[model samples]
Target: MATYAIGDLQGCYAELQSLLERICFDPTQDKLWLVGDLVNRGPGSLEVLRFVRSLGDSAITVLGNHDLHLLAVAAGLAKLHRGDTLDQLLNAPDCDELLHWLRQQRLLHAEENYVLVHAGLLPSWTVEQARGLAHEVESALRSDDYAEFFAQMYGNAPIAWSSELSGYQRLRVITNACTRMRICTPQGEMEFKFKGEVSKIPAGYLPWFEVPDRASRDATIVVGHWSALGLKVTPNLIALDTGCLWGGPMTAIRLDDRRLFQVGCNTPVAKDW
Candidate 1:
């Protein structure tokens, strides 16, 4: 069985289908791991959500920042932004079932020596520690009091990770690192202001993957945020966003052999997201 890790799907379901066809994905024998942002921005968020949810055990998806935003908006904790395209998903007949399934998805998924997260991990967290921390957020998200966690999930405070952290502070940092982070200090302090190209990544903040001695570096990480970094494949890091929501190409890579599969995308760019 083959497993293909795909980039952010941001509502471009047609492109995803084309890419799947080009890769000759046999859902019966092959598996798919989507790096998240499964819905939003593009026109087909609803369709993408339904198709992926229908995949059952054959597909796995980590939650992206956008995915979390949709949940927050659905719970009335957050408002839709200017270019947001998630209304259809929120109004779908199966919206509750879909969102519930999405909320149960992990912030980090590790298998076959590869760790997949929607974004990047802090330099201080080992893969095991990250998984434990991810479980913390997951537990709360799946609990009866999940709305309480989403209430505090939108902030950027506690912008650094600490094993000693507790309560919402601890959960906040874990969420930020796994979903919203791009650049941060070597000490793991995040910089949320810059979302531009890597060439202009500001000062003092290095891309999370480039942080010195990142503990998770011991294992390969597959991430799908930072479209500006485009598609990067190194021995230990795979960045797969590729700006597909902005009329770029949707990307997928076969995890076993690193074979690339891509299809052109034509969705209009909607801001920096």
Candidate 2:
């Protein structure tokens, strides 16, 4: 049985299938790890969700920013933003089941040597600390108190991590770090506004992975969410969002050999949309 880590499906079910077939995926034996964004933006969010959910114990997924956005919108905590293609998911017969399943999914999943998160972790957080903080959010989402948690999930307030953070503010910071962070100030505060390539990193901000003495640097962190950052495979990091929904290739990394596999996607450009 092999293990594979796939990039953002972003509703690209066709590409997702092709990539799985290329690797000869056997749901009964192999493990499929998705870096999330399993819905939205691409052409077939519903199919993607259904397929992954059907995989049962063979699959693991972390929540990407888009995934959380779908939950927030479905829960009425946020609006359906422009260009979102999540309407079908929001209205599906299995919508409630899907949303509940997603809420129960972990923010961080780890194996012996790799930890998977939808986005990067703060350099300050050890793997155990990140998992514990993730559980705080998961507990709230999985509880009857979830609506209260969703109500306070928005905003860039408390833009940094602190052990003293409590309540919704703490949950917000954990959610942002695992799902939306890209660049951050040297002081460990997140920069939520800058969405450019690495070269254009704003003053006082550096990519989360670039910070010195990062706690997670000791083990590989499999992550997506930074499509602009593209597919980067280093000894310690695997940045696998290859912009497949934006006409790039769907990417998969073989865990046993650390080899890369990809299938080109000719998704329509925004002009054609």
The prediction achieving the highest lDDT against the true structure is 1
Q: Rate the local accuracy (lDDT) of all candidates.
A: 0.91, 0.90
Per-residue lDDT of candidate 1, residues 1-273 (tens digit): 999999999999999999999999998999999998998889999999899989999999999999999999998899999889988888889999999999999999998689999999999888998899999999999999998898998788998877788999999899988999999988889988788898898888889999878898879899998988899999999999998888789999999999998899865665653
Residue pairs clashing in model 1 are: none
Model 1: per-residue Cα lDDT at residue 210: 93
Query: How well does candidate 1 match the true structure in TM-score terms?
Result: 0.98
Q: Per-residue lDDT tens digits of candidate 2, residues 1-273?
A: 889999999999999999999999999899999998998888799999889999998999998889988988988899987789999888899999989888888888988989999988999999888888888888988998788888899999899999998889999999999999999886789988877799998888888998999888898999999988999999899999988988889999998899899999957447233
Among these predictions, the greatest TM-score belongs to: 1
lDDT of 1 at 5: 97
